[model samples]
Structures are given as C-alpha cells and as structure tokens.
Target: MSAPVQVGPSSSSGGPAPLEDLEDLLADIGDRVRAERQFRGWTQAELAQRAQLGTVALSSLERGRPTLLSTLVLACTALGVDLAHVMSSDWREPERGPSMTPQQAVVLREAAAGGSLTEIGARLDMTAAEVGSTLTRVYQRLEVTHVPRAERRAAAVRMAVQHGLITPQKRTS
Candidate 1:
C-alpha cells in the first residue's frame, strides 16, 4: 500500500484554497511540511538526513525557492506529505496531455538541447525512426501540432521547462 497523501485543510470560510501565485503555493506546501516536521518533533536536519538531502537544500525548499523535482519529491516522501501537493502551483502547464513516461521525458530533454532526433537516438542506442516516434508522442502530450513538425521540438522543450520536468544541464568549465 502507498503512504497516505496528506492534503491541506480547506478554507474554514468554506471557500477553495487560494493559490494566488507560485510563492503562495510554495508557502502553503512548505508550511504543511514544517507542520509535519514539528508534529514529529524532528529538526530540519533530521528530516534532511531521512530524505538524503542537504540541510541547505531543505532550507531552500522551506523558503519557497525554485528547486529540483527530486528534492521536492524527497522532501515530500520524508515528511509524509503528498507529492502532488508539493508540486501543485500556478506554474503548472496549461496544455498538458497524457503524462509522459520517463523514457519519453528523456527523449524530450535530449531533444531540448538542440540535438537532432537521430543524434538523440544514437545517444540512447535507439534508431532514428524510434526517436521520431517518441517525439511524436511528446508533441501529442504538449499539444504542439500548431507549431509544425520541425518546430515542435523547441516548443515541447519550452513546455517541459515551464512544467519543471527537466532543467537545462548546467555547464562546468
């Protein structure tokens, strides 16, 4: 069985919770995480160790800054908070389609870096045709047909970035 996904209490005034912006959403989830941590009498350091994250990362998350998806998931898992709630925010994609598989996400991220489909296939040990098929599905997920086939790759990347699925690879000198 899965762990219970804890959600916030609804407004006492009988109105839907107002997630006015990204900051509000982050604050809401962070507050819940803090509450859960306090209820168990665990320090942020304790939870950080449990989550296999640094105390600094935990602090950043608690401060409502942009963070890695993995960090967010780890925090939720460690804190026993719903992963959905942590990821919920106004920054969500407005035109999401069927959820992409990890493989599909890999393909999209590879393509996002300006790699040709065949080049991506070479990196993944997949054939060019296979990469093309995978991209077709990604396009469907992002609803980018209006952008033309050749241009959909860039648009899909934008959507993925907007949805926080993948971040640009950081360069190291």
Candidate 2:
C-alpha cells in the first residue's frame, strides 16, 4: 500500500544500492514492523500512539511506503526492538547536507561523555539554555531533529561517533 522509500548510499562502499534492493529492504522492514506490532497485540492506532506518531504514518510504514528514518526509530523504540532487528547494522544514516562545526563537535563530545547540560555550559561559559539551543542546532544539522527531543541526544551522539566527531568512552565500574 505504501510506496517504496528510496535509500541513499550504502555504508559498506559508500555507494547507492540498486533500486530494487532498496525496495526489498523497505518491504522487509515493513514486514518486521507489522510482525512486531501484531506480536504485542497492538492495532495500528495503538502502536502509533505509543510511538508518538499518527495512524496514517504507521500505516504508511507498515505498507512499506516511503518511511522517514525518524519514524522508523520511534516505532522501533515503542516496539522495544533494536534497530538491528529491523535494519542492517551496516546501514548508515543518510548524509545530512551540512557539516558539523567544531563547536558543535565539542558540545556533542561533552554530552557523550556524560556531562549534563548545566555542567557542559558551565565549562563552556554558556547558560544551560544556551547549551540546549546549541544541541538543538546540532540536531538540525544532523537531520535528527524530527526525532523526539528526549531521544535526540542519543541519536545525535551516535551519529557523531559514526562520523568520527567523537570516540565513544569506555565505561568504568
């Protein structure tokens, strides 16, 4: 019922996939999403609500129509499924048009290192509100602003790490 979403370059070779391959991938994701929702006994409306999405959006996704990365993430989150379950780990986020600035990198690095907004701002001589706004801008640059605000930090940080903007820190006991 949904139109196939076009995919960008593949992560492995940084080249575009054949259109049919992309279509197959989208169909697979739709099938998996539908299965997950049914497993939980949720109707389209119920899953949409849990994902903070509209039913039409959910329907489009389930029908293997054009899907947004943010929509897929939100639905996967609500379904308590890992992205790996729905997509290949090798599948990277499509390239966003703008590059990250050095200041934005610093902000994301601090956040990834577990600094709170207040702490990051204090060290950077900015107000917490200013830090939040900066992060918002960074999210925009990363094209992840469509994700819920609560989930943006994690999403952006993951992207930053993938882009070599920051290295993930090791956890200490």
Candidate 3:
C-alpha cells in the first residue's frame, strides 16, 4: 500500500497542519471514497451532482479538506457506500458468520463463474428474481456494494478457500 498522504499545518505563509490524527482519518476516508467512486466508473462531477453539492465541495472533500458531516454523508450515499462503515475505527478482520450452505454456495459459485442470474437460477431450480434477492442479501452480509465482476469472482474464490464451495477461476483482466 502507498504511504498515507500527510497534510501539513497551516502557517502564516500558508497554513498550519490540522490535527494530525483527524487529518489522517479524513485522508483515509477520502481515499476510500475516491477508490469506490473509481470502481463505479463515476467522475467527481457526477458524484457531486448526485450528492447535490458543488463540484468544488466534492473535490475538497476528496482531497481531505475539512468538511461538514452532512456533506460527507451525502457524498458516501451518492457513491452507494455506507458512511458508517467508512468512518468506523475498526479495520481489523471482518466478522465472519456461519458459512453458506452447500446449495447457497453452489448458487454463489455459478454466479461467480459468470453465469447470468437467469442461468444460475435455472441450475439451482430457483427463479431469477429469487436468485437476485439471495445475491443481494449475500452482498449485504459481506458489506459490499456494487460487486465488479472481478470482485464477485474473488468473493467466490474466498468462499472456496474457506471450504464453503468450489468455483472456477474468474477472469479479471
């Protein structure tokens, strides 16, 4: 991982550095927001529009400049990420729940193997809508939003490694 960016104190000539820990926290949050935005293929301008904020404001927040709580919440909402998760102090291992059942694992594996919702549903003897709903719940439990194709595969790969299911390798490139 790249070294965390440092914000200097603001001086008379420029400005003193803000509180170090707070600045670092904000910077970390900003980086995560930027990454998620990029993952979703959205521009700062688009995020700003969706968040009902000026482009400059959005830019400032993305730069880790001091910003209002409401603005941060709005920006995170627009990015389809939970602000609470982003702001939480805990960055340790994510809590693991009961492993998925064999049937559910098969469903996930098929989906991860690039099977369309309809195809996976047919294979699992479920309706497309039901498959979609189950997948949504899985994503929620994983605390993931907007799973890129690669991430979907990774999730499956992780499940397999954990002995939950076996899935084919996913093509990420």
Q: Name the candidate that leads on TM-score.
A: 1
Quote the lDDT for 90 in model 3: 62
Q: How high a TM-score does candidate 2 get?
A: 0.41
Arranged by TM-score with the best first, the candidates are 1, 2, 3
Cα RMSD of all models vs. native, in order, equals 13.7, 16.0, 18.6
Per residue, candidate 3 scores C-alpha lDDT tens digits across 40-82 of 9999999999999899987887787788954664565444344
The models' CA-based lDDT, in order, is 0.70, 0.74, 0.64
Off by over 4 Å in 3: 1-98, 146-150, 156-173
- Clashes per model (N, Cα, C within 3 A): 0, 2, 9
Most lDDT-accurate candidate:
2
Can you write out model 1's per-residue Cα lDDT over 1-173, one digit (the tens) per residue? 12233333233632233323445556555667778888999999999999999999888777766677445544544444455665668334446444678999998888776677788999989999999999898888878868977778888888876665666666668
Which segments of model 1 are wrong by more than 4 Å? 1-98, 171-173
lDDT of residue 38 for candidate 2: 97
TM-score of each: 0.45, 0.41, 0.33
